[model samples]
Target: MELNPWAVAGLVLVALVTYYLGHHSSRSATSTHDFLVARRTVRSRRNAAAISGEYLSAASFLGVAGIVLKDGADATWYPIGFTAGYLALMLFVAAPLRRSGAYTLPDFVEMRLGSLGLRRFATAFAVFIGILYMVPQLQGAGLTLGEIVPGAPAWAGAVVVTVLVGANVMFGGMRAITLVQAFQYWLKLFAIAVPTFVLCMVFFAGGGPAGMRSLGAPAPPVFPKDTTVSVKTNVTVKVNTETYFYAYGEIDDGPARGAAHWSPAVPHKVASGTTLKFAAGTPVPVVSDIPATNDTWLHPASGKITDLLQTYSLIFALFLGTMGLPHVLVRFYTNPDGRSARRTTVHVLLLLGLFYLFPTMLGALARMYVPQLLVTGDTDAAVLMLPSALLPGLPGQLLGAIVAAGAFAAFLSSSSGLLMSVAGVVFTDLLPGRIRDFRVATVLVALCPLALTFLVRTEDLSLSIGITFALAASTFSPLLLLGIWWRKLSWPGAMAGMIAGGGSVLAALIYDTVCGYTGTVPPWWTVQPALISVPAAFLVTYVVSRLTRSGRPELVNDIMLRLHAPDPLGLVQDRVVARFGQVDDKARTGRGRHRKA
Candidate 1:
């Protein structure tokens, strides 16, 4: 079956209605504050939902399942690392950063260090990271639309999302995007949650193909039923336990695509637009890139040194990276105050943890039931295809539709936030800060990613997003953390560190993109740059800040007072939490001096 029309229609309908409502309710943004940070009036719960909506991008929505299906237990660590990054944010940066009262990261930089130069420097990093993140989201949209309407070109879905996102940000700015993103969070949750439940039930009832533990095994999968697999793209696969395979196009070392190709003992190229018919009991072939065995896939990095190094680097990148994401920090600015930001982060942690469980299940399910995807290199389509592969008839179609809708929601919510963030910065810092300038800024910031989506050729959704995180962690994380928590962090040090860290990751991104060096197998030490880049950033910041003090902002004391002090005069503090929980006379002055010591 190629392209489900009903599913496609439902997804487009959902996008149109959500955007219409957001456009309808757009708060006439009259100032830079309104466009950039929603006037800092968002409450905890609502802000939390919007944050989760954007944060759960295509990587979280669909890439997780594909990673799990392809890599097995070790890849489960990816979700843990992602979830932990938010926790690190809650404890280390959320409250104080919100308390800083800046609309954007660059705004915060200027406010903290009293340097227009550093702010502009930060603006550059924000733009780079934002475009990098958005490109993959657009690509994920292409992948999703292709799944919905097979043979659909890559540019179609990207253009659709770009138009919707542009309209929402252009008219309403943060306010409109917030509402749209919040709606998407629930839609995405429902999309995946319902399918996971029904799929689980079916597996238990029908007693799934072989054992469910076959994931990562090199052995070819035994087809449970005579299923006809379609090769949507060209791929090379080596047939395992050869049988009388009836397929179309050039096969057995010939180019992929066409009919009447027999399965040879050796590896052959399967062209696009080809159909491969296999007897239900035929053993499936393993593709070229991924491992062929269950043990390696199931227990990846099983005490191996390289895997361990790669895993730790990934963890560090994610852990520190959350604090630096331009879109994420923008959400904190929407909170009513520091306390509300903290509270919203708690909500985010719980929601993400609960949502990730379903992806793990789906990944395992795909590996067991849809192993043919390994040959086609469409593991990313696992979540989209699992429902129909498990349950047939109307029920499967409906669930499949839900998943497709959710995937589209993922693309919309994430790209919406990132675009708003990058655009807001451009409006405030690059161009004039007039309210109407936001529309122009939105167009300008979007062009890079939109062109990238169409021109550069997108790759794995999760991996590209990961590169951005590594870049952010390397560039801005140390700056944010040090600026907020350290009194001695000078503007010079911050600028130097930002350059050092961001420059390093930027080099890696360029090298990989230009040389085609980044792939399933990459050169040593370059796969995740956080290992070197993050530390280099921190160390540079510390050494420079300690050595040079000329650029320290004179207002550092005043900024610290605001960050650590209770809402002055109760004007900003008048919320549901009436009293200052910890700040009373002595705490207000300074949490009590180190007396006896």
Candidate 2:
């Protein structure tokens, strides 16, 4: 249980930088306008960096690589969908969303549809989606600190991240965190990119292209050296061939728990708190659901219809979900105008594309170097472990520290944005739109998700985030797309569609999680509900909207004009100012007709 001093130093440095930036930038946040939208003065490039930082949550930083390491080629779709979702946003949603002149997604819903009820409904879902997305970031933090500082409980990391993020948001709000997030983005990029370059150089120098070819070999990956794996959670693994290992825990569902030699001819179950030691050259035992051989893993198609369905469903969710994410959309509101927002999206696309390439490479390398993680089913630690595993000694420890700091940065930046979005919704809709209420909302929103981190068992970080995306895709995707593009969308229709879409995804998530806990295999749709839910949302919204055409807002034409018209035309009004006070006004006395609506 020895702690690495270098890693601790790296984490402390990032925390100091984050706090300094937050405190320095917070001096100007005297009004709700600055706290909520940074007074809409951010330019394209810096805003893009902040958006990229916030968008690249634990799922992107850790989950993508872990999934790729465990699932093979199919995992590539996760990043593709993630990046392409922004493409969808850039093309159809980004400029208009910014032009809508709303501080939050619920604000947009109410501004467009003119229904207080619908705004509250959207607020509820916004909080839900934010919390759902945040759980992964918190869990990833737990996984990371646990790996670096041995014997640290998972909750310790979650608490540390929540405290840092909560303080940043409560004190500085969006204005301060913008600077912090932008800085962290470059730091995260360096953290992942440097290790990838060094490891690739070593791999090529060792075996060149021949080493690359070895990854595709038909045999299962083997332990590069004798390794001891600690299983923190119960998992069932499939042994491809006869293997002997020393184990100290409950095995094969037995009440007797003690040290024993495990030689399994069939699948084996290992209980939590188990420790197993494997000899060098022992074939790795992977979780039962993962591919055991490299050949099968490298291939794109699993030849199963369910696999095909799941892949397409996942793609659909990710492609449409970006626009629906509350944290991502709120960043655009920080842009000065629609044009800046569009440019920011373009820059984000480029930044995200470049960052994603490294994680995929890291995952491929992990298969060769960190096969022991497969047995414990804790591949989420692959990115943090890879540097130390490959380099060894002081160099590896330093690199590991760098990666750990970057991972924490990932959690902090993403959690800050999510908490900001959720707090904004709570402050505006649930509480009075006051400056102090904003601070309270930040505390309230952070606590709910922090508590949730303890109850929900951590799974694949990317997959858990994907479910949140599916919820976003099903609910808000329909609302935003139809509200912006369709002229006849009614408030009742929007509410109904959100319920249909959000309800289905939530049901599937609960059922699937229950199945996982009970050791039962759930159906494919339970895992990826976008294919069934997204269309239902759009269809229900359309049909109900058509049926309730009379309920359409009379101001729909004005809203549409503002959304589509160029910024220079001056059709878009400053709704933030209309609801809260002006950026310069400290009286907090500005409430217009729209606030009442």
Q: What digit string (tens of lDDT, one per residue) describes model 2 on residues 165-218?
A: 999999978988899999999999999999899888878778321222258679
**lDDT for every model?**
0.79, 0.88
Candidate 1 lDDT by residue in tens digits, 75-184: 78778988999998999889888877677889888878999988898998898899988998899989888888877888888988999888888887887777788778
Which parts of model 1 have CA positions greater than 4 angstroms off?
Answer: 27-30, 207-218, 227-277, 514-521, 568-597
Query: Once superposed on the true structure, which residue ranges of model 2 sit more than 4 Å away at CA?
Result: 207-213, 255-265, 576-578, 583-597
Give TM per candidate.
0.89, 0.95
Q: What is the lDDT of candidate 2?
A: 0.88
Query: What is the lDDT, from 0 to 100, of the residue 502 in candidate 2?
Result: 92
